[model samples]
Target: MLPEGNEMYRSTYEAKKAFKAMGSGYTKIHACVNNCILYRKEYTDMVACATCGKSRWKVVEQKNKIYNNIPAKCLWYLPIITRFKRLFQSKTTAKDLTWHATERMVDVGVLSHPADSPAWAAINDKYPDFASELRNLRLGISANGVDVNRGNRSHSVWPVLTVIYNLPPWLCMKRKFIMLSLLISGTPGNDIDVLLAPLIDDLQLLFDFGVETYNAYAQEHFKLHVVVLWTINDYPALGTLSGCPYSGFQGCAVCGEDTHCINSLNRISRVMMVIEDFYHMITRSEDKRSKEIIVDELDKLQEELCVTLCLLDKHFPPSVFDVMIHLTVHLTREVKLCGPIFFRWMYPFERYMKVIKGNVRNKNRPEECIAEKNVAEETIEFFSQFLKRVDNVDIPPNNHNNCGIHKGVDSSSITDGTPISAAKLVEVSAELFSKAHFFVLQNTSEVLPYIKRHMEFLEHIHPTKQNAHLEQEHSRERELGACRETITETMRWISHGPNKNIIKYDVYAINGYTFRTKAREGKVYQNSGVSVVATDTHISKEVVTYAKNTYYGVLQEIWVLDYHFKRIPIFMCDWVDNRKGVKRDKFGYTLVELKRLGHKGDPFILASQAQQVFYVTDPLDQKMSIVFKTPPKNYKDTYEDVDEEFSTIVPHNDNILPRVDTLDLQKENDYFRNDCHEGKGQNLSTSLCGE
Candidate 1:
């Protein structure tokens, strides 16, 4: 039968007994108060309270009424009894009686023996007088008569009272037996509600303690965050705190109000601490339960960390451009190495520059007239100075030399007698420097002799021959020919006698020929003056066309002359004379037959033909026209035979023109007629040929 304490236990025990008495082989009974208990006919089957030896019949009705009235009361000591019963049944031996007694008193309405009720008697017998004396013990008395003060002298006794009052009446009944067992066996607080109450309170206390601890931790850990917020809230406090030893632990000096500096540090520390704790906890856990607890703690810590970071961001102001730059450098190198964090740190600087650029574009703002420009200039200067320091750095061998010009001294020149000149040194340095450095120097250096030399070399090596030829040709036609013609025409016009009126000779083109004559004034032509000018109008189109044609003609002649003079034959053959002759027979007779058959009639004619054949020469008529001829043997016979011919012909041409009357009149008439048809006869034959 089951052990009895509370109503549930009593009912369960009675049911077990009834079951046993009925001769049912199924004597195993499961009790709601305790756990399942096994009973054999050979073992004891009666139900009795282990605490007071109260019979199950006496307590059963009271236990049922208590169980019906308060179900939670049944649960108070039921677990303890159930655990003990299960133990006894499993072992089939007498279990520790302390657990059973504790369950019984806590379950049923029972109290400890009189000796254990010292505080009870004081409360029951002394009443108001004892309560007044207890209040004088310096313990703070609550309105409900409970001592709330932890420092009270009677504080130790308070727990006993609390246990009794808090437990159900059924549970109090077994208190003496439970206390005895507890003293002997060292089992404490076997009542389920009593044990669980303090644990639940402690859990709440731990939570509160954690909060306080976190606040203190935040003060130390998030100093930067706190300082930055303080600075932003009370700007003057920044200067006051500036003297503090922990001042450097605050925001950036340049952009002090901005929180990026401190936030970066806080985030880094938090993430690192969390990761470290996670690893420590997981590694140190002894079992799955402990590991799970640790994991849960870590999860909570992570959530707290996230909340902290978010709060830091919300409270802290953004950094300025200058501050961002400093923050990025400091945070990346010293605080945090996260890529996203670095980018966030740099974004402010980029945005600031963009804003500055926009402000510069706004013309209405006179105050910012040069502000944007000045800032840009300063930024450039700053970068330039920074680059100077970077350039001075001696790069490691493995590092790429990005300097445009290598600044390192030439080892090759060290072996030479003379030290390399600065100019040559720069040149040599340029070869070793990186492309980035080279271009940077190229832009910055005002007098870069190396660059000048490089440009010169490029020009010299790749000269434009075709363009040079074109320029030369243009110079001869425009400057030389035009100037010479203008000067000569002016001189000629001046040499001629002037009239009373000042003459103006306007040189112009009539068709394709250049003409110079006096300008008409009041129906009279002027002389002794000439003016020359270039015009784009079609009035001078013919002259330009003629000039162009003449230029091209001269160019062609030069080419032809060069070709002919430079040409040579590959081979030559010896001269040979024709020696073969054939005799022709006249209709009269053959020569050999004529000798044999010489007749007197044809003898006179034949004899005369033979005698006067030498004198029978035809009369030759000769006419001479002016022709150029070179002196014999004056021309040299070389590979370029025609070159010699050109030299001969050119020099002789001055005297080769026809003398008036001897010129072929018919030929001149034909030329004049052709020129007339071409509308040039009047101008050419009359003015030039003196027709």
Candidate 2:
């Protein structure tokens, strides 16, 4: 199919050969049918398994099948040391390998990366020799079984992967840095340890005896060392990997002999204390004194957890107590030893598993298919690094990449959305258009002075008019550019307002968030919850009537206005009525009634001024839902002489805990009272109560 002058591979064999030559190769080790042992070292020459007495060759049918002595199963093992050397061969990656030690912002109270955690510090304290070299690597391993064919539950593949913690937080979790160490096919059962023999041997070697490797960045040969810090997996997989009982009376790995259980329940169970809250409480950006106070109180916190668990064990049924419940006790200790659980978790590994599963083209030979495709991808990625001004095939641009203020830039440069069509266009009504124009002007820093002048003139002309009326007259006058005082070129055009032919969008991405209209909320993910902190001020009788409040709303429409030189995006939202539509639960979660829409007159906000939030439906009331603020992803906030005002969006851990009224808690410790109402109650006087 290729042209006569084209230089391309003619067949799959040629392409495979080129890829193998360019990339680090994988080893195919044979295994017994019953998952007894791997055919390596001592077992290499054996015809059958020594333990299970199972044949290593495939059992073939006499009529049609050929009697080739092919191994029943094979484990694809990728050597780690060669991949490590390859990472150092690239100057960009070599410099990034030491970022944990060199470029990390060492804030004592903050946990941005695993390097900021106490576990990393503990390693440094124990091994001064290893810690002396900044280039040394700390790694985390994770393994999980994924079914290649959804139809067949019996056929599974287990992939052992490792993440290099030496890289910065932004780069470490990325798919490029996560390496596939081993691929075990079929049911390994309890013999997973046997399958992991080769990888473990290499790890043991790297730990005890370092390898001499060339650093392309430093341009010198140096001894490289590594340490496997921890393992990330789910409960059952954790048991499979660690050889610990994840279920039953003695399933609590950390508790050991002190594990609490009840015999009444057929299966072992225990209460899971609120462990997430405890961890989130201490994972804040606090001062040295505050951090010290939290650290010193760890024992006290553990004691409180023990007491809470005891209380739960007494009240809750035996069935409510499971292995997951008992695991909560060890979380605080893990926090102290391993830092925040968010840094080292199975979520990223599970996400990467999907990428691995996508490479499987041939179901008959899934292992070989995955290995070959991964090698090809790695080869392509390596070559792309050297090519200038070319997009990497494997690494796509992040959705949250171009976030924050893009001031003085056109909409086409900053905004990403579908191309506007005449069919999707909706003309803005004069009333709504004026309101949206004034709102954009009110929020603009350059137009603030003009607003103050315009408001003062309105108050002077209509002394007897109410603040609300004067504001309405100001909006009407501004649309016609009829202000008594002269304004700047920017303000004049802004006041004159945008084109009436407004373009509508169902979805739009800006300011590090992807926003969808309420019409599109039928989809799986809801991205329509819009919020903005609005300040309303009225100048009357020298009394500045200022009210600042956060308005929660459902995004109804997205409209972009054309001002000839620039296009500004605005969202028309259905704001919930704060008086009747919104209330705070006992846990301080802002719950809103989506059915009760309000704020009809003022419905527009600048896309940049809005912060994304979501609503989780309350189990007790179907009409109400708890509000959750969405944090910006992959955002770097240096805050060093930045021109735009940087709004510090809440960090990942800060919003994990529900706000509670301490006074109410002190009065009554009804932790699990079914009768207690979550809704806020009105203050009633003693006389009114008596009446």
Candidate 3:
């Protein structure tokens, strides 16, 4: 209840509810009419925008500008601290908030998770103190601008979102789980760090002095430590956030990994600079001199990053010379290791942005609309924890999908790939039933025993050698069209060429296994012998690794033969490699990308022996990456020596980075630059940061 002196809100039920539902952590700060800093805290007393010298407040006849009322613009921040606290309130989700600590498999040099990557390990080693808190919260800060104005180009809205990595994957990208933490109002601008100053300040405080909060489930209070694992964005946003060239000859956020493109003949002549073999120094020999050389070469790659920055064409904006490529990576170093590039990326947020845009009806005040929607969504999500659902999964379940574990073994499991309810193996759903029956037959030796048990169960119901009625439709069709009209007797036993038997029936009236919450996929066909693994299934047999290598199979049995009692699970897969020979099921074939993931088209893997392949099954996931080896001698370096004044003169397609950079940026125009530079549109008219 509010005090009697309070005039803004009354002590009433509606008012109290409104106050409770309100997202008021945001600070209303004034900004320059011309794109500049959002005047706040230290700049609160300042009368004008620091860069443009424009008055911070609007002149009005109604009343003198009050900090509480409408200022020049509003930067709505739903305090991250508050959001972090709420993450632990829900009993169901509270357990997931510490997944990174509880379940991240590490130490074996596997790139399966960010927690296992080299980047994560280094960060922990670097900051033992911060890493000491087993429950320290981790996050992926993702931001991108979306055209919320239908398809209008002139106006745009960029919402800065943060995903709590502490929570498991299912909730990480869900609209209800994401935090609409900061809303940078108006059309896109390059001054991100300026807008992010407040958020960063709060983050700094959270890092230094963690908030003390009681975990309702744990029943004890502990300091809630947090760290922004990494920032996620596309190339242009990465450039804007890091303050570096993201296109042109100099455009590469990772310093040396920029994809080089040749300038068209009509454009400026492009110069492709060759790089020296830093590898030779690091690997050619292991002597003291070679080690020092390796260190020097490493230093050169990191050299101010200015050498690479200086190589950009002069026509490029001065910001192109700022070599602060991927500055957000410093967080990785502090934490030890961040893992692969895609892990802490904005793809999830970019997708979730659709939900943010869907919430907007009136585009006039986009930030306000997003704020209201985010709070409401979060509240609904919090309450939904107390309810039950028959549909989509509410928890992250992965224990049901490894080795030969399927229905009958663990019948409660359900996978996404499989249908939800128990599909009975019958004539109408014949293909589905056949697939399952074959999986049980081909993968496991227990198929016969199970079929025997099944037959015994069936004899109790009705003793008969006929699902003869099931073949009636087929016989009728042949009689209607065929000249000879031969009535072939169907072998009712589990039929596989010459494999049908009297006791082992082909059609088992059984429930198709449900693995709705399993890994890789859900819903096993009867026995879950149908495992769709990647083409590289030969290497690691893990169907979950790469989609292209995936093919459905009946995982038959686990065999431990010669390799000193090693358990090996083998599959009788339907290979996409060859349909000409003994290949059984031909839905699709192997897809292989030399350097990419998605298929270019059908017949992805161009194997010459594709048609000759006969054996389709093998030990699954048996060939996963088990060794880290050095490159062969044939590995060549693309390089040449560089001078201080050397400029990489190359004309490239301007299709990159939605916006380009300018010298002044004082005039509001379409240009995007990296956020690594210290000043506005940094100008390096004379020198390129002293490389």
Candidate 4:
């Protein structure tokens, strides 16, 4: 039999080689199995590891006809210069690189993007040479060891993922955009530092001498400036990445101030360390004196961390510090940069783990399967971006269209102009439709007229036949659409008048869900700066939903159409920015900050409103409260213990008396006496004894 790397497979292999040649090539620097120096340049000829004295090859035989295994681990590097230019290959993604400076921060009331910070501007100021060119690129890096088995089984597959912060929010999460710069794999217990040396070396070179690359966004070439902003990971991953003992005593990454408790890692463990986050500490609305006091303390703590991370302190050593901690303090130097802890946090990566997990088809070789899937998806995505209908292709949904959100392409007819409510009613059933119309019970006289006009306008724009054949086809489409998925909003209806019986009408689900059938009741004034009560949030609990402590907000808009074929009392409420409001027990619902809610778009919510009156004391001292339904919950030791006798599963003999029945005469004589029980003399004797 022939060996696997034979000449017959060369043609196929060459094609793959050609394809990979187009991509960034990696440098495979072989290192000793032990923590020895890399075998490169002059050291490449050495047969044994200089530091560890280990053989360079598994087999001593130098000359071989076919196959041989090298006794060394390889450290790989994907060229930064090649990877940087990849961001601009697509025109859509290329333009998004400038979004940080352009569309991010125009209003003074809001600042959400990192570029809006003083740190970004400071970096620009310090590097006047680089900042002279507005096309300078900034990068954020995150690294973690992903177990190929999706937590089902353990396998070493540490992949370092790097993201470009310059991209917009929509494009940032893409697998194609996220570069797999390095892949670290070894036998059981390999110090990550040994693997990271190559990457660190490259990073240093990239920083010292910026890579010269073409800016496709701009017509000319420029020095592509870059910096490793942060390394994001979970607590345990941080411990591994930072070389900090976060799980043990003196473990908190932020403070590193040990509580010295013997029992931790459970029961109010050290893991939940209270870190008055730098951003939170600075943003709080406090007095000047208080602010100064906080700033003074934070400054001291920051310096302590810096000193500790540098291993300059007498107590600390290089072994205790890792690259993550040293780079973390860099954020403290400039306020514009999100704190080191926050910038490269693992939230996005954690979410992306699901995407990676989904790509795995073969459990035996999950890494290979995921690599193939990721490449295929990225390749398809790259080609799809070049064509039109990018939205459908970019966020490639499931093969089946069962998405809770409407599946139809967004159109002006679905939700176009703001609908005006009618003041009075007028008969319009006769004017708009023939006797064959399906619209029954118009909300009001004026509402009917508006509906009629809207229907006429809709028919003029999207004309449809009233014939039985077309009506059947339309009915079939509506049936399939409704049955396939739950339609939340009526405005986004694909077909007007589902069938012949209820159609020839005007407004579809245009009006929001409401129980009230009358036009007067449907007149919900929803516009900018209108006060309203809202009880809709991601964290809303059944207990809090029952409480009348609904958030007060300015009205955004209220759709007049019925929602989901039911008149639900639903309307959109814009969040009001009020500092004077009292803080109620949210029961875990975090208060939505005005700036965080949305910077440009005024945050609004569509919720079902109820007449839940919350009576309060006035100057006159009046008192009243609305009826509320008690939330259902498990009786978790909250209920009083029942009496011991009744608590048992089987009924107690003392509590339950013996059951008895009245005896009846069976003979035609119709008299029951002791003498009649001759056959059972014991019963007769017992009866006589009783008498």
Whose lDDT is greatest here? 2
Q: Among all windows of ten consecutive residues in candidate 3, which has the lowest summed lDDT? A: 630-639
Better of 1 and 4 by lDDT: 4
TM-score of structure candidate 2: 0.78
- How many clashes does the backbone of model 2 have? 2
TM-scores, all candidates, are: 0.11, 0.78, 0.50, 0.49
lDDT of each: 0.23, 0.71, 0.44, 0.43
Residue-level lDDT for 308 in candidate 1:
29
User: lDDT value for candidate 1?
Assistant: 0.23
> What TM-score quantifies how close candidate 4 is to the native fold?
0.49
Error at 648, model 3, angstroms: 39
> Model 1, stretches more than 4 Å misplaced?
1-75, 79-691
lDDT tens per residue, model 1, 559-620:
00001112100000011111111111222111111112211111111000010000011123
Q: If ranked by lDDT, best first, what sequence of candidates would result?
A: 2, 3, 4, 1
- Residue-level lDDT for 95 in candidate 4: 73
Can you write out model 4's per-residue Cα lDDT over 361-427, one digit (the tens) per residue? 8776565555655544545555676687565333544311112222222222222222233212223
- In candidate 4 the C-alpha lDDT for residue 163 amounts to 77
Write down the TM-score for model 3.
0.50
